[model samples]
Target: GAGVSQSPRYKVAKRGQDVALRCDPISGHVSLFWYQQALGQGPEFLTYFQNEAQLDKSGLPSDRFFAERPEGSVSTLKIQRTQQEDSAVYLCASSPRTGRKGYGYTFGSGTRLTVV
Candidate 1:
């Protein structure tokens, strides 16, 4: 019954560097999602996975951003060649099903990445 959790709630990276953030979803949840939220903006879907299968990733901004859920539970988001524009909050959420409209998502506090 653990809740979603993310590490390095804050991260500072230089331009052209790579960073990897980690997420731990709730146990028994069938769906996991990653989202990017800019300052004062709503969270935008980045990718989603059901168990170990990545069901959707259309929201990934670019090829530089990659994610994986190899074990069907723990997921990671890796950013290659970080840029100033990549600075934003990376959120991880998990739900009981694909239709999260009612059950909603349990989001981690988020990893705030700052690029300089």
Candidate 2:
């Protein structure tokens, strides 16, 4: 795709249901990041992958959250046993640089998860 593309722009999950959000980043982007945004709050880093390797996952809220980019192109963020507090906008971003420090990322239109 020309830009970062995310699937299921909006998702509604039951409190205990699991959900998988997908992100297809621009071709050749070397870095991918997943972020969580609560209502009226800025996006918080969730995880980061450089190529197929997960370089950092310190920002993941809990064990229930997992992110992967096996082939380093398409990625998925999965949440298990979703809770009401998990309701938020999940964003995917990609950059050509190894780290996000000096480069700007191309972000996808987030997938908004609503837990009820």
Each model's TM-score? 0.94, 0.95
- Residues 19-64 of candidate 2 have per-residue lDDT tens digits of 9999999999999999999999999999999999999999999999
- Could you tell me how far off, in angstroms, the CA of residue 1 lies in candidate 2 after the best superposition? 1.5
Q: Which segments of candidate 1 are over 4 A away from where they belong?
A: 98-101
lDDT of each: 0.95, 0.94
lDDT of 1 at 27: 92
Error of 2 at 79 (Å): 0.2
Clashing pairs in 1: none
Question: TM-score of the candidate numbered 1?
Answer: 0.94
